[model samples]
Target chain A: MSDIEIKDNPDIKSELQTPPEPGYSEWRKDENTLYNDGLPEEEKDWFCDARPQKARKSVQVIENFLNWARSQSLWILAFGTGCGAIELRPLVTSRYDISRLGMQPRPTPRQANLIMIGGYVSIKTLKRIVRSYEQMQGPKFVVAVCSCAINGGMYWDSYNTVKRIDEYIPVDVYVTGCMPRPEAVLAGFNKLKELIKAGKAEGQNLYIERFDWYKENQKKVIKDWNMPDYNW
Target chain B: METLYKELKQYFDVDEFSVQKASLAFLRVPKSQLVSLLTHMKDIRGYTHLVMVTCVDYLEQDSFLLTYLLHNYSTHCDLGIQVSISRQNPVMDGIHHLWEQGRVYQRELFEMFGIDFPGSPDVHEPMILEGWQGPPPMRRDFDTKAYSEATYSHRPRDHKEPEEYMKQQLYPED
Candidate 1:
């Protein structure tokens, strides 16, 4: 009975070969690798025609909407990644009253329009920052607080702290100091507000549409298994 | 105009002492007299606050730039005294003996940048990380990305499987 059971077992396979599927290669091409002939003759007329006028009109509307939207709100993601966070507290606290200028810090990236990457962002924290930036809705901005975030003020040589956050994420404002003064941090905040008011704060989606660099960098900064809770 | 600067200049024969337009003064003193210089700054200069003591790692130039950002509530001016030291085996005396706040900044500079501050009460224990074993993590050579991957625990990131969605659309599950 044991010998018969062993011979009858279906788990073992004598040979293995990859299955073949027709039109597999035909469908596998990325946007850039298309073959004109491979497309159906009937549908060929419907494909690849440049709509310059329609494209222009849509661009104009989006440009107008974005310009108007940028002025109304400029949310800051309070990263508070290091000791520089100390100064930021007073800005938001009762003394400085940062909210007077219609500015308040948001904890979650999803709700933030700007990311204040306070102090030196270590590579470990950078991964989280990148993920946060991604989860945030469109029209985002970043501020590198302190000289450390710009070029690693004192921790430049340390293995853990990144010299510049710009290498990992695009920064719209840079406040310089070992840990920048409260006034300097306020200056950066004001600069962000001015940029937003000027209708200059463009969203990352513009770059994401033009080039694949953002997408490639997004993957490189964060490992495939490390990320969770991303928003649509 | 601060008495501490005047006193130190007389006693130490500092190389240069020039006050910038911003009301901040830059005092350049001999490296040997730094300890004495710090002592007088705290005692007589009215520079009571030790804002931060940090080092800039300039590997290409082979120097560690030490900056002491000091503020005097009495005088109401912020002064940043910057000094460059040799990168290899850097050492300096702890000024914790002078300003009480220097203790934390000095120890922080030591742990974060590995600049040895002798007489510091606690310089070896990790402040930002646990069980760190390697060159000072802030040095230009230290790869932060690699260290982060090896050290810290990360949360999961969401990613959609677009191809899988397309396949599911064409072929329904049983």
Candidate 2:
């Protein structure tokens, strides 16, 4: 019995009709506005934040299901920039069998949502890493694959290596130790999966939002900057 | 090995020559005869295999010893030809012509020690370190740790977050 119904009208017109409260005028961009208390500058997170985030709420059932599906099936990128990448070999092989957890290494960044930064990033390699990170599709995540990613590990005093990976790019998770064992790698993935299920791992969106800050930090170390504005 | 020593004595003007116990020969030649000696070793002595071209900075002597190591596959003997150049101007003859691989080694030496190889074109190009403005790192006076600290930004030194965390962790009672 789909009967026609009339919905109540919003009271925005009535608010517009009311006069300003005793010299409270502060250059009203929207004259019919209901809320006047602006959010504090400190409350806004775009300034000096580690990563960018957007409030994309999954309201519909289909959107919720899609988010669930994305969490369940993550295509990991096979890009390893350091020596720690050797550890990833055993994880994919018969012994570890990471494929059982619905994670497999994808060759192309465009198809993959997960990137494992498998080692120390030199200034030379940082450029390529930035390009590769940017090339990855949205709803992507980053797992810093070693202690080298944390603080350059053994190459701590070396002039060429970058001490921290987070300064240049946002990392969703960090696998500690010089080279974390296959079990540790799996645990790191499990943690990432938990975050992803909760829709907390939004590094890909964060990168896009705070790209200028990331680019500036990148240019400080990389002197010969000749790539395009956006790598994508 | 004995014949190689004999040839070194006959062909080149040398400061000292000796045969080491471990199937090797050592010849310390003057700075002037470096190129000629290397040419002779390559052309006549059949020590065509260029093992390496390295330098050692002797700060006390105020000179840098440029050593050219050559090996003969047939005889299985190593010969180190040494030439000491002034500390002020450590320049050497580019023997990349005799052994083509010497270009890379000399280029690396040039990058690390500022020992100029005049004829090698790659000496001016960027070798191991790109955009290196500081003094040659391998020199005695060029401090590696100081230069490394000054040139690049490290984590704990630049950001004290980890240090503070460690301090809190180590002294939790405090």
Highest-scoring model, lDDT: 2
Q: After superposition, which runs of candidate 2 have C-alpha atoms over 4 Å from their true positions?
A: A1-64, B15-21, B157-174
Model 1 misplaced regions, further than 4 Å: A1-69, A206-225, A228-232, B1-174
Residue A188 error, candidate 2, Å: 1.7
Docking class of 1: incorrect
Residue pairs with clashing backbones, model 2: A52-A206
- lDDT per residue for candidate 1 within A79-122, as digits (tens), equals 88988888888887887877776677887788898888778776
Which lDDT value does model 2 have at B9?
Answer: 75
**Number of the predicted model whose DockQ against the real structure is largest:** 2
Residue B37 lDDT, candidate 1, scale 0-100? 68
For model 2, how does the per-residue alpha-carbon lDDT over B41-122 read when each residue is reduced to its tens digit? 7887788888988889899999998888899887888999988899898788888777788899988988888888898976
Model 2 lDDT per residue over A24-120, tens place: 2332223232121232445333222222334365676766677678877889985688887899899889999988888888998889989899998
> Candidate 2: what lDDT?
0.74
| Count: clashes, candidate 2 | 1
